[model samples]
Target: MNAFEEEREMMLRVQQADFVVVELTLYTDTHPEDAEALGQWREAIKEAAHVRRQYEKRYGPLSLLSVPTEQAIELGWRWNSTPWPWQR
Candidate 1:
């Protein structure tokens, strides 16, 4: 495969993984009742966490949603400066 193909494949994998983790997150958010689901849910969460850690270790810092990175601009006197939505 070419570089574009390889990059596209990686992106698709990341997207699919994020979708699975998102479903698990929604379940965990309302993780009150349903003991059986809770057990299965915990396993899912654990698996997702492992996958995420592996991805991050291979790549750089990343969010679960795969949001594009917003970089910080540093200026000594200016203190704090950040990326705007348009910049992103």
Candidate 2:
């Protein structure tokens, strides 16, 4: 796939992972003893973090919250110049 398509697919994967984590969290809240669900939720969270970091490293931070001040300075405040997620 081309660059844009690849990026889009990565974004979709992150979104799906995040959704699964959220759903599993709610399920685990009532079924606190469900170890399997909890483990699955943790894995989903890790996957989301990994995918998000990859996306940020390639396309810039997804939001202000995702950008550390030191890293932003190191990058010369390029976030301002980069397009927003929707714009992409």
Candidate 3:
């Protein structure tokens, strides 16, 4: 695939992983006694981090919370340099 396609695909994966984490967090908040849901929520967080790392490795970062890579710094990547996810 071309660069844009690859970037879009990775971004989608990131979004899906984040969605799972958010949903699981809400579920756990309401069902705190559910060990199964809590476990799933923990796993979801890890998966989301993994997906985020993969995307940032290729496309800088989705947010400022992430540490910028040396290459990205040298390349002058700023948050305003590109469109945000919703803007895209």
Candidate 4:
């Protein structure tokens, strides 16, 4: 695949992972006593982090919460760079 296609696919994966984490967090909030849901929520958080790291390693970062890599710095990626998430 070309660079754009690869970036889109990775971004989609990151979005999906983040969606799962958010949903699970909401579920756990109302069902805190459910051990199964709590476990799933924890796993979701880890999965989201993994997906985010994979994307950021190549595309700089999705947000400032992530520390920029040396490679990203060398590539001249900045927080205010164009094609932000909505623009993308």
RMSD of each: 7.3, 2.1, 2.1, 1.9
lDDT at 54 for candidate 3?
Answer: 86
Full candidate order by TM-score, most accurate first:
4, 3, 2, 1
**Better candidate by lDDT, 1 or 4:** 4
lDDT of each: 0.52, 0.80, 0.83, 0.84
Flag the better candidate by lDDT, 2 or 3.
3
Over the stretch 1-88, how does candidate 3's per-residue lDDT look in tens digits? 9877888899999999999999999999999999999999999999999999988877676777875665467887767765754455
Off by over 4 Å in 1: 1-18, 24-31, 64-88
Better of 1 and 3 by lDDT: 3
How far out, in Å, is residue 23 in model 4? 0.5
**Quality of model 2 by C-alpha lDDT:** 0.80
Cα deviation of 1, candidate 4, in Å: 2.3
TM-score, cand. 2 vs. native:
0.82
Model 1, CA-based lDDT: 0.52
Residue 63 Cα positional deviation in candidate 2, in Å, after optimal superposition: 2.4
TM-scores for every predicted model: 0.45, 0.82, 0.83, 0.84
Q: Please count the clashing residue pairs in each candidate, in the order shown.
A: 0, 0, 0, 0
Better of 2 and 4 by lDDT: 4
2-52 per-residue lDDT for model 1 (tens digits)? 755654455556566667767866876787586877776777667666655
Top TM-score hit: 4
- Residue 67, candidate 3: Cα error in Å is 2.7
